[model samples]
Target: MIEIVEKGVTNLELSKHLIKRLNYTQWKRINRFEFAQIF
Candidate 1:
């Protein structure tokens, strides 16, 4: 039971990291100067 909890936590952390990285990549592809102007 304790091991399962640890695994779940690790999986969640990994998922969060992946999502952050993906968002950063998408953000970088945009024109930063215009991004703020449009948003």
Candidate 2:
């Protein structure tokens, strides 16, 4: 039972890390798009 709980915690942390990475990439893309429009 303890192992199951630990596995769940690990999965949660992994997903959170992935989400942060995805957000950073998306923000960079948006900045590039806006910069292009300005010129």
Candidate 3:
């Protein structure tokens, strides 16, 4: 059905956003840890 397809698309977009956010957070943590070690 058309509604199901739309829901799937919405879910995919949401998942992508969540993944990007998580990746950004992880990268930030790694950078902070490295900086702390250097200092």
lDDT of candidates 1 onward, in order? 0.56, 0.54, 0.53
* Structural similarity to truth (TM-score) of each candidate: 0.34, 0.34, 0.33
- Model 3 clashes, total count: 0
Q: Where is model 3 more than 4 Å wrong at Cα?
A: 1-9, 24-39
lDDT of 2 by residue, 1-39 (tens): 356446665644544554576776764565545544543
lDDT of 1 by residue, 1-39 (tens): 355446665644544554576777775685646654542
Clashing pairs in 2: none
Candidate 3, residue 2: CA error in Å? 22
Q: Candidate 2's error at 10, in angstroms?
A: 0.3
Task: State the lDDT of candidate 3 residue by residue for 1-39, as single tens digits.
Answer: 355446665644544554576777664665545544542
The segments of candidate 2 whose C-alpha lies over 4 angstroms from its true place after superposition are 1-9, 24-39
Clash pairs detected, candidate 3: none
TM-score of 1: 0.34
